[model samples]
Target chain A: MTLTSDRVEVAADPRQQYEQAMAERWSDGVPLLPATDDAVEAILAASPYPADHALCVLPPRNGVATVELIAINAAMAGVEPAAFGVVLAALEAMSEPEWNAFGLTTTTSSVFPMLVVNGACRDELGIDYRASCMGGAAGRGSMTIGRAVALCLRNIGGQRAGETTKSVFGQPARFGFCFGEWEERSPWPALSVRRGFRADQNVVTVHGGKGTFPLADIHNDDPRDLLYLIAKSLAFPLANPYLGNPENGEVIVAFNPMWAERFGRAFPDVEDLQRYLRAHACQPIDLWPAANAAMLADRGRVDPEGRVHLFERPDQFVPMVCGGLGSLHAIALPSFGESQMQSKAILSKS
Target chain B: MRTHGVYMRPHQSYDAGMSDPATVWVRRPTAAPGGDESAPAFRLDRAVSGLTIGVREDRAWRSWQLIGDIWSEYLRRDGAETITVETGAQVGQPGSDDRKQIDELAAVVDAAVVGLGTCGSCTTFTIKDAVALEEQERPVVAVVCEEFLVHGQNVATHLGHRDLKILVLPYPLEARPDDELRAIADEYYPRMLELLGVAS
Candidate 1:
């Protein structure tokens, strides 16, 4: 239900009252929508959820999310309803039992849900599939959709750090993080498809991730060498969520499509990259101190020979091709280690 | 190093102060009922029986361990059939093997109780395990430490669940002596019972 429809607090004309939205901290150092009633309503109209429909129930102080509430935040993020639908779908997908919102949200770990969009909608919506898609100048999908979720988290969930939230120096992505899997450009099958979605499905993959750990390497040419380096990058001492075992985590290595073609030339099959990444995402025993190493061994995180991989399955690398055709870089979106991605098809409507 | 005192300390300005009440509701001092007595509760009907309980043999961050202890304690004392899940190995930290242990534990138990376990890495996997259990249609309540309640709540809401409760426990996963533990348990257990709607 709409929870509270007690008049939306009548105000003067939104256009006249509004100035540059930059001054409000209601932004990620960017402009924002004022969340005017009209604007919010227009967005809400596009969704299948009634304005009163309860979309979610958030915690530590579980707040119920209604459609209008989501719209208000979406309006604040300057999102169109079409994109808003994607946000709704993404949020809806994350609500799945497998996404484990309860623990991810409550833990002291700096992990939050990162939305990875895939399928035909990625291109149709102009989601940046490569080259600074996660950062730098923004794409509407990356900026608005991501920002909308952050706003929803803030406005709806009431996640104020040091208050209900105990995050120590929370990461930047908490503000908003959205990027598309560059499937057409990647060397491998689309992430959504690999996860069992159809070719045409509009899918949103919800990954509980701490934040984006930039994996930029320009020196290597061969995709294998580059992937090997990328795997090593994911296996870094701090990169592994558990210092004891490499296998507890999942890392998504986002390859720009240009490199995907090349990587495919070297290893055409998607499984080849998964195998390569799995083999290479290893850390030397020296990376951990003896005591820590012992702890890892004791926990069985370390192998007998002391080899620790990021996960038992090489496919945990979660390879996806996304990004512009830029050949030199790949962004590694590290898993929060607790929340694996929960994918759901994006309904064009609500 | 301690943030609790820092957060609880009064700010530079105090416009108004209130008289101390005869009682404050929340049981754990971790949330500092003195700070703000009580919040809403995530309750259950009657009592849950036939459950296993245990936390990982891992050092947890914040109060994640508190949750595990409380969960196990709750299930144990609730007069239910309870067992604790085990990795059959010391599996903590981030790794596939740990996931396997969690998977195994989840399989072994009627349901599972996983927490962020304090560290960022383990928290992620804890979430993964909880979700996995849900896939098996097992009733799971993933505990979120005091701080992460909202984020966890938002996640739960987004996932479209009335179950998969995110239990809120205090942080600074240190031990209180047995008497204090019992006292602490005495303090909140009634409220816990009240919330869960159990006539304990």
Candidate 2:
């Protein structure tokens, strides 16, 4: 297959090539693999779309992302041919209007796309879902796939920090973050399945997550008490949900396998668990200072009981089981407030 | 020269005598920027007396709300009917309603001043709302803080509205006292009208 992207000659020396990438601002402050024609072609071979297909217009700059361009970036990220589809799926999901990529990409907030994968390919692709899956797992699929998407944003979308994007304090996930759900250990159906995809299909769900908010509980063993505390913690006064409309966004609460089992036993239905979490995910109007309280009241956010609910519906508190078998810790991926989580089924050239 | 799957560390020694050192070819990753085709900007080019004007304010910025209120008062005093709308949500039903309101305001008002682009996304939305009015053939001006002036312009340009009129207010409008905000409102009111092509 013929490649249509602009090609440039570079030094044979690895060190010199790395320096060239850095000098050209092509690297994300990390060494990237050279996107040679052979490498780029290999990635393109795995894509469902043709090399010249304009996939979507990424925002901040509204650059047109073509399959060939995405493949070149994927090659630079060292993404395997088999994993290129994940990157494609992610961009498609983000381009959805409700995803609000235009707003999220340029916001002063620390939000970035966090990819959660579910499907039969998880194990084959080495996507980590257990034991420090979010970080420290060093899975090739997780690292390279996530980095590829970030590179696409930087290169194709033109999302430059402090420039095109005014992100105040970009979080670590900006380097690229992808993880899988432990389907076997989960009490509910896989996140993709819950979202209407089949259990067997590989799906990528993109969340405009602000940052990983950690919650730990060593003293409480009762599921209700633990869930209550988790809900309250998510409703921290400064959360983006409290700052704007309560109807938008979802806060992903990740439970370790052990806690999932306990919580699952208490509320067998995932929707019921979400309802429980939503019921407690609120704070009294008195919790805020007069000014903030007045604003909340003015916006009709304050309830008749003086409680300001974090979200309007149960589904806004999305729950998924992941992480290590070790209990007592859960991670909350806070929302960007305006963006809705979007999912797309991954399509690959079989 | 083309090289594939070559692994040579920086510490490894290379011999010049053994032919030319291997070189590789790679594709440029960045996408090409969009072309510079911008839409036309409208102007009222008439007096404000007996005309209706719209002022769009963001709920997130109280300072802008205060300034918007002051500007509304000024417009009324100048014998112009004023309609003001406060928008907060950027997505969901509220966001849809806000966009609809801006569209309706564009239809009814001869001109509009959309403001409080102090933050990143807010600036984008501010320019977007202004563009909506401009698209409807209504004279409009987008107001942004000093810090987000470039961001607002960039968003406008990307949306193919490069010539969209923008008025830059002082940065960090928040945390300032009401009197200071009022002074700023008074200072920038004339320029806002000027950008909207309001005649002297």
Candidate 3:
């Protein structure tokens, strides 16, 4: 493997590489690691697929994501070669027919793939599952792997912010978002296990999250009281759940480990907790302007009691135990409402 | 040290003094297959005149509804019967209801028209419905805002319908007034008919 593409070669120094890429408008305004031959080949050697193996044709640009191409971007993002499997798995999940990558890559909405890792690889890959897991953890896997995927979307898929993509106010997560579930601390099955993957399997679940909204509560010790308020917050009038048809999309509610333990003690079963959340996740119809309320009625969203459920089914409220052991805070990754969260197991090196 | 399951290999030193630095071996990304060559084998012949046309309006956009309505009126004036359908689902977010509506519409109409593929997802859904209509052997024309003209065509090719008929209207069509939309109707109507192969 060597630097052979038509892409111009400049001084191999990091400073020169940055200048060259920036001058060509290829840099995502961030300094990129030089994708030298040794760097790209090292990443490629970790892939189970052959260098020429075709992943999927990325949308907007319709660029074919061959293994070698993905490695180049991954290398530039400073991703560890061993974690290339997770990056590939995330891209495979997005290529699923249901994920609606074609729609997501080009949407005017500020949505991006929120990668959630599960299984033993979380520890192995150093995916952040503790304090500031969504960011600020400074873990290598959490930082570089997600950035690699984002660079692929930018360079290979050509999802330039204002030029190619109509993404109005593109969120910070667009740069790359990867987090892990605190599976050991959860009462129920881990996210991947519940999604039908083996407990030991490395899996990446990609969700089209528009943005993250943090929820905090200093009081209300009772589980029901806390959950009621949280569920109500999840059903914000302007959220994607209300804006688009809610039957297809799902939301992820990340509970700090302490809160998960409290909720688990009260409900005993995860389904029960999901049901309670779904039931209370509605707002009174009067909460919306009359015109909007009428529109909700037309979609069969508002009920006779002037209430509208956040989603069509209880299972649509995905609860995952994550973040630190803090008791007062949680987070919600609101869905884009048009796509499904898809999971793909990472391929073990053969 | 391999901290997380990943570890980087040490970089090979680059000689900064070399005049012709070795070319970087980045994988060249492949473009969409069969560009411009995958035109549909079937073109509209006499299927459009006195056509029982199904007009699909994506609910997310305001312009498509007006465009469909105006087009339907002109088609009706041309001795054709038009049945208009509005999707309950948001653009690019088709559900079972949307599929059912498109299927039912395909069964009854001789041809179909779907619009407002100016944005990302909406354009995908517009092509989706248009492909469904074509699958049923009904001639279909996907109308998109000029901004998404290439995108709509690319999606069609990706869906294995290389020759799908596409009508590109000016961009920012949604914010235009009724008179402007009507003028657009008058200007593009014949071109659309020609694309549909409506016989004089």
Query: Which numbered prediction scores highest in DockQ against the true structure?
Result: 2
| TM-score, candidate number 1 | 0.67
Give the TM-score of each candidate.
Answer: 0.67, 0.96, 0.87
Segments in model 1 whose C-alpha atoms lie over 4 Å from true places: A1-4, A10-31, A243-249, B1-200
lDDT of each: 0.61, 0.91, 0.81
After superposition, which runs of candidate 3 have C-alpha atoms over 4 Å from their true positions?
A1-8, B1-36, B41-49, B88-97, B100-108, B131-139, B146-191, B194-199
Q: Better model by lDDT, 1 or 3?
A: 3
Report RMSD (Å) for each prediction in the order shown. 11.2, 3.6, 5.9
lDDT of 3 by residue, B38-80 (tens): 4353455774556698899877666678778988988988888
Residue A75 CA displacement from its true place in model 1, Å: 1.7
Q: Residues A1-350, candidate 1: write the lDDT tens digits.
A: 23243222211334322322222223445555556556776787778777777777654444566777777778777788777778888778666655656555555568777888987777666677667777774787778888888766665665556554656667878878888876766656788889998988888888878777766767878777777787888877765455423434468777777777887898878887788887777787778888667656666666666687676777677877766666677777787665557788887652
DockQ for all models, in order? 0.07, 0.49, 0.23
lDDT of 3 by residue, A287-323 (tens): 9988788878877887878799889889889999999
Instruction: Encode model 2's per-residue lDDT on A1-350: one tens digit a residue.
Output: 99887777777678888987876678899999999988998999888999999999988888899999999999999999999999999999999999999899899999999999999888988889999999899999999999999999999988999988999999999999999999899988999999999999999999999999999999989999999999999999999998899999999999999999999999999999999999999999999999999989988988888899999999999999999977889999999899989999999896
lDDT by residue (B1-200, candidate 1, tens digit) is 11432222122234468543222111010110111222222333445665443344344332333444665666676755554443311222433465676667656655555565343334434444666666655556565556555544444443444345555555534454555545554565454444334434
Best by lDDT: 2
Question: Lowest summed-lDDT stretch of 10 residues in model 2 chain A?
Answer: A4-13
| Winner by TM-score between candidate 2 and candidate 1 | 2
Off by over 4 Å in 2: B1-22
lDDT of 3 at B119: 81
Ranking by TM-score: 2, 3, 1
